[model samples]
Target: MSFKVAIIGRPNVGKSTLFNRLAGRKLALVDDTPGVTRDRRSHAAKLYDLHFEVIDTAGFEDAAPSTLQGRMRAQTEIAIQEADLIFFMVDAKAGLLPDDTTFAGIVRKSGKPVVLIANKAEARGAQGGMLEAWELGLGEPVPFSAEHGVGLPDLRDAVVEALGADRVFGEEDEDDGEIAASDVLIGEDIADPDAEEVPAYDENKPMRIAVVGRPNAGKSTMINALIGEERLLTGPEAGITRDSISVDWQWRGRPMKLFDTAGMRRKSRVQEKLERMSVQDGLHAVRFAEIVIIVLDATIPFEKQDLQIADLIIREGRAPVIAFNKWDLIDHPQAVLAELREKTERLLPQVRGIQAVPVSAETGRGLDKLMEAVVRTHRVWNSRVSTGKLNRWLETILAHHPPPAVAGRRLKIKYLTQAKTRPPGFVVSCSRPDAVPQSYVRYLTNSLREAFDMPGVPIRMALRTSDNPFAGRAKKRT
Candidate 1:
């Protein structure tokens, strides 16, 4: 129930200072150099019991027409457009510059309310620079010194006024300016390493699932059946869904967010701006998603683009469940299901052992099974396997099928350990990492998948040469 606010201004205008002040932490590095921050940084914060998310962005400064800065400016504009509120800061001590006037015009066009802050107010008086700020046409400025911790209350009051009274943030406590509510999550996710306690995420927690696929693959139809409401705008047009929308629902009473993506077409074919934006927006949904359910048109399943998209999910370390949509279209042959399974196995070998369910988004066929696939794959994504058990499995794998002969020498894989697990990435120390063929790497990966019962999960194995397997060996032969 928290809202998001962004601190934006021209470079070196104490925007980062204001961010660090409101955040109550030194998350953003303060430096005299302008444009130090190149990317958008988001953090949770509290301003007088009004708990919310805040974004510290790269300060905008005019560049040589169209350069990297210009592209980054586009990203900044997008962030400003997305945020609920903005803190348009200007250095009162330095006075308004020409670029500031230019930026003021840009902010005015955003159509979102802005809180203009005359920063560096403690340097002298707000008289001179505050007068200069009047020409920007936003409104009267809230002069404050971020470094000196001044004028924060006026900033807080401005936010409450903009958000209104029927609010999630009731009021600030009379004592320490913290929210009096039990539900609010306080402080940024970042904290001091020595005394900080992080909020742990529950993997058992119901995650947002997205069903992304090509046109008429039953995205709208599937959601309609899942929620028992024809909520999505579905039509016969190839790319009718120009927006990726989310719906809240539950699986066995557990909360979930489901995103239905538009039909992705070839880059050469996407003519309209809406289509291009829809594709980009759909990709964003994929990145935010915990488990991405890739709905496929079963008639032409595992097309090059579908495979590429599925690979992209695995590459991003996201758990994916392939849903063969329009399953009802295919008539049942004597071994049609078996044939489909084989096709999936061969075409998308990268996501080996992953579930590929057959379902019709139109008729809600196999949705129960689809949810089961989603839950299972999600569990596998957040899964962590013990190093000892993994090493033992690796031992068995190496014993059964030793590495291929290279230069008339059989390479011995000395040890294997699960270094990290998001998709269960493993590091195997061997005689020669480069000499190990892709087929052999595939062999070990396939073996690990079967041994761990890790169906619907991507397995990653990397080969590296160990300097010494017997580093501390002594003469103990008996």
Candidate 2:
């Protein structure tokens, strides 16, 4: 089992920054504003050679029950209770406040190993604050700068000692040996698509899928129904989910990692600091996911925001499966389904023939079909076509609809070859590539989609003028 560490402190203590530092990327949103984080976010973190699950929690606050801050505080308590070790952080620049001392006592009461961290230690003025941190009774505070990376080694050593060297680094695991700093994997390492070829779907690697929609769109309920348990908190309230929570499960024996994100509202509507952070976090999930399921409420399908979200997914190059939730609540299912399909075709012409599955996330209806669509779209998104087959297909299409003349000369189309596929990027070599009209490019894109059976996934095509080796030399000589 991997070690679990929770970073707990008051608002603006740089806990999120430290969490990002340990994770080796900016997974958490960092801002100068206090109380920016509301819910607990966890990721598989690597600190040097140590691999552990690190959780970034909301700032600790003393608030009355039934308040929003109270709920946030409860979430932080859950993280603290579940963690094996706690990094009780405090702002060295701000010094020890009464809230820090109060929370430190709470952390001590949990009986988990505690490592006091004095962040912002890079400032010369913070020395007095670091000295004052000893009174918390946790232990000698590890003076460190989460922003400047001044004392990461000391912090890592402190964590190792707190969790024990053997526990942090398994003794008998031969393959999981200590890795060099250069060998550390960042968050983008798993996200960066393979360059030239579409990666085969591996059963071992869990397919990351994010389910997102507007508020009260039944996103969490849908996830609960799929997992066959109420693993997420759901109610009649809008904007319930504040964090992008990931749940790991097996779908038809295939490993899957599902992310349930906060409801996304219009930019103008997102005025609060906390909600803005939540939306940003949700967007991050979409970028990281391989397939994005845009959940829509069947009664009010294809709203302006729904279309906008779909557009965002296509622009991000993630395979999208449009799902209509609350189908059970809709009247005249046949007509509604027909209209939804027509609207999808008209509004989202960019991803023609996109998969639109109607399901009742509440009653668990049409779930199998949704999963099937997800798998199929994911396969197509990673599809690649050989150069010979692509060129052959291009020849047939070109014969049917020849390129239009531009500036008194017909564009000479030579060859077409697929350069890569995550979204199936292609390169077309021809004469006067710049003269090719966008309408012709669109026709080729549509034809390629139809010919290859690649629907709902983005396809990239680039026009390149064929090179003449001796043209530059001849020009120079002349």
Candidate 3:
């Protein structure tokens, strides 16, 4: 059985740095700013021969139960309850502070095994702080440095002794093996016209969905409601989440992974470096996710930033589902829903027929409809159309509205063929690709969307010059 360990400490105690060291990857964002980590992030960790799960939690602080810091402390308490061991870390160079002493007593109340780690021991004057760490009454402090990999073996030994050597070094866990075929998605230039169609929803592989929007838009609240647990920190304060947290969840017995990303604002308005990093991380999640749920506040829906986020999702070729959040505050549900639908079609014509579900994350309303829309959108995103059917539709479209004349030579539009799926893309061969007007291309795109019943997903069409080697070469005098 795998052991669970929780890293608890005051703000800026290098808990996240140690977490990255144990995880052997930079999964958590580290910065000089205190309280950078606000959520409890867990990952499979390995220390030498010992392998187990480690959780990184927000720093412990003394605040009211209703304050943001208090909510953060509550999350840390949850982590403590779930962990088999606790790593109460402290700064050896800076020594212990009042907050450290106060929280140490609290952690002592828990019956779980505790390992006191004194980080930053490499510094010249750290010996004095290490001496001070002994007063916390947890145990002997293990002098270590998370930045330079100091005292790792001693730390590992303490853990082994605490959890027992047999359980600490158990049988090796099995590997997850190769990625499922359904996970092979997203690349440019689909050369094979006859490649097998994308498989239907593979329930075994977890679907990745990212929830993103502006600050104070209830992104975390929505995710917490879906998981039916306060898995993340939520408060009245804006920008409570700093890291891109991913949670593995299930709905209707289908495995799913939800990513809660930091809120994004306009470039001009985002002045702080940390907020910029958070926004960039959110964008990365949007690009990697299969479907992006753009949450818009119902009180002020369709703001410029909201439209920009939706457009960005489309440009990334990821399926998008808009959630009209804060619906509980809306006075007229039916009228608001109709108005929002109209605004969606008018504002985001690129992905026509997009589903905008009015949802109240505060209450448990419209959640079922929201998920149904998500599953349906995923189906459309991965769909493919046969080449023959595409060519037939292309011929009919061309016969109705022929390409306009450029330099007195009408463009000869050849047959159409699908290049790829996962946000379906197509290739249209024509006589002069450069001469095709942007308006004409938009027409073909709309026509394809309507003909194939593709809606709410970005559709790409590349105009390539018809492949004719002989025609390009000098015509022989015959």
The candidate scoring highest on lDDT is 3
lDDT of 3 by residue, 1-478 (tens): 2789999999999999999999887778889999999999987788987878889999999999888889899999999999999999999999889999999999999988999999999999999999999999999999999999999999999999888977787775634221132244564455667554534655455588999999999999999999999998988889998898988899898878898999988889999988988988888778778889999999999899999999899998999999999999999899988988998999999999998899999996888899889988988887788788888888898889988999999999887888888889988889899999999999999998999899899998889986676765876798
Residue 345 error for model 2, in Å? Answer: 1.0
lDDT scores for all predictions? Answer: 0.74, 0.85, 0.89
If the candidates were sorted by their lDDT against the true structure, best first, what order would they fall in? 3, 2, 1
Instruction: Give per-model TM-scores.
Output: 0.58, 0.79, 0.94
Task: Residues 28-110, candidate 1: write the lDDT tens digits.
Answer: 65677666554455655777767777777777878753564664466577669778888899999989999889998999998
Please give the lDDT score at residue 294 for candidate 1.
86
TM-score, candidate number 1 = 0.58
Give the runs in model 3 whose Cα sits over 4 Å from its true position. 171-185, 188-192, 195-204, 471-478
Off by over 4 Å in 2: 46-50, 62-70, 90-109, 118-145, 148-161, 172-205, 215-249, 259-263, 268-284, 360-364, 406-409, 469-478
User: What digit string (tens of lDDT, one per residue) describes model 2 on residues 23-92?
Assistant: 7777677888888677677876777777788899889999975676777788899899989999999999
Global local distance difference test of model 3: 0.89
RMSD of each: 11.8, 5.3, 2.4
How many clashes in each candidate?
1, 0, 0
